[model samples]
Target: MADRVLVTGGTGKTGRLVADGLVWRGIDARSATRRPFSADQVRFDWADDTTHDAALDGVSSVYLVAPTDRIDHLAAMRPFLERAVARVPGRLVLLSASSLDRNGPMMGEVHGWLDAHTSRWTVLRPSWFMQNLTTQHLPSILEDGCIYSATADGRVPFIDAADIAAVAVAALCDLVPPSGDHVLTGPEAMSYDEVASAITEVIGRPVRHCRLTTRELAARYTAFGLPEDYATTLALMDETIATGAEDRTTGEVERMTGRPATTLASFLTGQRAVLGSAGF
Candidate 1:
């Protein structure tokens, strides 16, 4: 049982759910956020080392959600993580991406750091979120009945953020800490074209996949206000996906949480009202 778990990015997609789950299970969950809007939330910023110790205070476990603004996640997070582990002597569960394998880059380096620095750690490498279609792609869908991607027919088994959180909650609450990474994914893999078709079927609206070259996609991301380097990196990931990098599924979610991961169809059904409300 976690004496006190500090969930960084408490208001974020997975962090919020992880915090709620921990609290529901009767563990003390300290939600760490730079913008504190409620009780039990402590100020925490990866850029602000001054806020680190306070967030780590009395915490027996940590749920680390890296900052999104930077590509060099290890440089931004390592100091706080080191301080956190040194002070708390507890388990640390990091939220990473399935695209980033252990010791590869970014969150991968953080995973390696955890492996070398502590015995109590868990790394969650979840695939793209199913919610991305409802949020990130929603604007594009609303603007035009199309989903744009640089990935040409690449299949991805996008996992729900809820499933990721379920596994994270279990990891954070476990008395016996897990020692390695879990590569998580949904049960089925589908391409961007198939995704558009699925959305069309679910919402009763026609939608198409608009394919682009990686360079074009990177330009699109830059136009939308991402750093050029980061945008290029993200677009390059899509190129990698095109080569079938994200084409597989894994049982990590169900294996960890003792429940089958949610399917894309079920997730879409649950979000039908939202999808339809947008005049789909």
Candidate 2:
């Protein structure tokens, strides 16, 4: 039998793409979700231990996507991970962020643990995703014709989720996947203004970037139903970007996937229809 890889958060943006890519490559891909959307998806919840064993069964490789329901996600996911390490062979690949260091919060702690325990593991630290503009930030963009942020003139090498998934599939399927941390980003760094201009060009609309204070941004997130602490932390990330923390690019994506990272213009072009229908 082919190696069966378990993908947590299978219904999510990146996880769904990863599962599809693995299946396309003729691998036995299993999606783990609390509510299985398809027959291929097994019931699994990071906060529930009862689902862990069945999800891990016959799974030689695992894709770990942390839960988003809580700010203290590491605590919620630790038990499942402990069980994974104890029960399964450790060919684990974790989805982390480029801004988060190994010792940082949430997945950062998991990165540290993966490095120390897993014999075969890869940590992907991708920068802000281009998909965020289409998904998470879409509602605001549609309603106000603007993209809101606190990063003043700071640039991010926004990567396409497809590119990230490509790299992830490579990692999960490779006989000897690259170990250690890999920082993934697009070919170039772009500011929010540039991002808005790109969207406007592709969609032929007047979408713009609306700059806000960190406090204002935090308030917006809170109004959107995030906890006060989480909202503040997210706003603080924008402040970090304003300090030029995320103003860089890397060739790791190209190196790993043997292709250059997807550009913002290209991504915008492909997503133009969706943006238009969403009130852009």
Candidate 3:
């Protein structure tokens, strides 16, 4: 029988695509969401231990997506991960961020733990997702025709979540899974200003990037109902980008998936309808 892969956060941005890609590759992909979206998706929550066994049942490989509600996410995830490593036989792939160093903070702690514990594991540390413009930041963009950020003039190789998913599929399916972390990025680095211009050109709308101080950005996130500390941490991430930490490109996407990374322009062109729509 083909390996059964458990995809945590299967309804989420990248995890959904990962599950789809695995299915397309003729792999048995089981989506593990908090609520089952389909009969195929198993209910799994990192904070809830009750859902773990059913999700892990008959599953060989696992795709790990950390819960986003808390900054100290490692604490919440530790129990489930311990169970996963103890139970699952195939490789484990973790979804982490490029800005976060291994063994540093948040998902980094998970990264460190995976390295020390799992014999077959791969950590995907991808740069900012281009989907952010279409999903996370789309609300403000549609309502105000502006992109807000603390990363002043910072350039990011904004990768498509699709590319990240492809890489994850490769890691999960490979006979010999890559053991270390992979820093995935797009073909080129682009600033928020350039991203705004691209969206404006694609949608024929007057969109602009509104640069804000870290404190202002944090306050904006807090206003949007995010916890104060989580909001502040997000703002700090942008501030880190502003310091030129994320202003580089990598070929890991092509190396792993045998295809060039998706360009921001192509992503924006494909998302033009969403960008121009009144309801996103």
Candidate 4:
């Protein structure tokens, strides 16, 4: 039988895609969600330790995604991870951020711990996801025909989540064992304004990009009903964006997947309808 792989945050965007990719390759993959997910897999929750054993049972690999916006997330994730490592004795592929190398607050904690953890593991430190612009944030932009953010002159090699998933699949199945962090990015770097222009070119709509102050961005997030700390963290991420931290591409995805990473224009073209829509 194929070795079972457990996926944390499996219902999430990247996690779901990674799980699907594993399944497509005829690998035994299971998704772990907060509550009982409807898919034909074991239900698990990080908040509840009782669910861990059943999920990790017979699993030879795990795709780990820590909770966001927590600077000390390593402690919170430690219990679950310790249990999984001790019990499963398999590969652990952690989903981390590329910005962690520069001491970015929240992601850095997870990055630090994962790097030091002595086990068979692979860390996927991907740049800002192209999906964020299309799947999550584009609705608001499309509604007003303008996207508001704090990023000003920052350029980021926004990566495709599908590419990240593909890399995860390779890491999980490869026999040589996964090692070191894989910093993945798209083919090129582009600023938010450039990203907006790409959307306009694909959708044939005049989409405007607006740069806001960090405080203003925090206020906007607060108005959207997110908690204060989370809002501040998001604003800080935007500030990091404004600093041009993510303005670089890497060959990690191509090295693993044997294909060039998808471009922003290509991603926008595939997601033009969603970008044109006002609601999800």
Top candidate on lDDT is 3
Candidates' RMSD to native: 1.2, 1.6, 1.6, 2.3
Off by over 4 Å in 3: none
Range of the 10 consecutive residues with the lowest summed lDDT in candidate 4? 102-111
- The global Cα lDDT (0 to 1) of model 2 is 0.87
- TM-scores of the candidates are 0.97, 0.96, 0.97, 0.92
lDDT of each: 0.89, 0.87, 0.90, 0.79
Q: lDDT at 232 for candidate 4?
A: 86
User: lDDT by residue for model 1 over 54-152, one digit each (tens)?
Assistant: 888899989999998888998999999889878876789999999998888788889998998888899999999999988888888767888889999
**Candidate 4 collision pairs:** none
Q: In candidate 3, which residue pairs get closer than 3 Å at backbone N, Cα or C atoms, i.e. clash?
A: none
Residue 57 lDDT in candidate 3: 91
lDDT of 3: 0.90
Q: Rank the candidates by lDDT, best first.
A: 3, 1, 2, 4
Which 10 residues in a row give candidate 1 its minimum summed lDDT? 271-280
lDDT by residue for model 2 over 37-142, one digit each (tens)? 7779999988778899899998988999998866676788888888888876647889999988996887888888877776777889999999999898888778
